[model samples]
Target: MNGTLYVGVTSDLVRRVAEHREGVVEGFTKDHELKRLVYFEAHDEIGAAIQREKSLKRWSRAWKVELIQKFNPFWDDLFDQICG
Candidate 1:
């Protein structure tokens, strides 16, 4: 909630999330300490998921927070939830 969060698309959710958490990929996620992954959506089509990621990325920070709170009211670090 106090740091940057990235919205991205990948075929393998677990691998992608691991990369972010481990700092394996560079750019906004690595630079801004955006590893919380407090929200995400799964799609069968990569294109659709990428599109959604783009739409979410374009949204203002406040909008993104509100979106996350729709599912995670406390903005918990969803990486832990995913791992479990």
Candidate 2:
């Protein structure tokens, strides 16, 4: 579970995730297969999501993992569920 994690904000998570999975967009996520959508949040405003993303990016790995585990204790790949 020490895999790479890429944090960012996207209004259209579905399309954005598709790009990451296909490697259409090159970056840390693509290089490390960090395409698993293990955690996500819905905000009424993009600004809120952006702020939250920044906050998450600054969190320690343990803190981030705990946050994810709160909802997905097994760290399941939620890509299909969210993207579907």
TM-score of each: 0.83, 0.90
Cα TM-score of candidate 2? 0.90
> What is the total number of backbone clashes in candidate 2?
0
Which runs of model 1 end up more than 4 angstroms from their true locations? none
Question: How many clashing pairs per prediction, in order?
Answer: 0, 0
- Report every candidate's CA lDDT: 0.80, 0.85
Candidate 1, lDDT over the whole model = 0.80
> Where's the lowest-lDDT run of ten residues in candidate 2?
27-36
Candidate RMSDs in order: 1.6, 1.2
Return the top candidate by TM-score. 2
Looking at model 1, residue 1 earns an lDDT score of 70
lDDT of 1 by residue, 1-84 (tens): 766667778887778888877898887788876667778888888888888888998999999888988989988777777667
Q: After superposition, which runs of candidate 2 have C-alpha atoms over 4 Å from their true positions?
A: none
Instruction: Give the best candidate by lDDT.
Output: 2
- What digit string (tens of lDDT, one per residue) describes model 2 on residues 1-84? 687767889989888888887888877777887667888889999889999999999999989888889989898878889855
Clashing pairs in 1: none
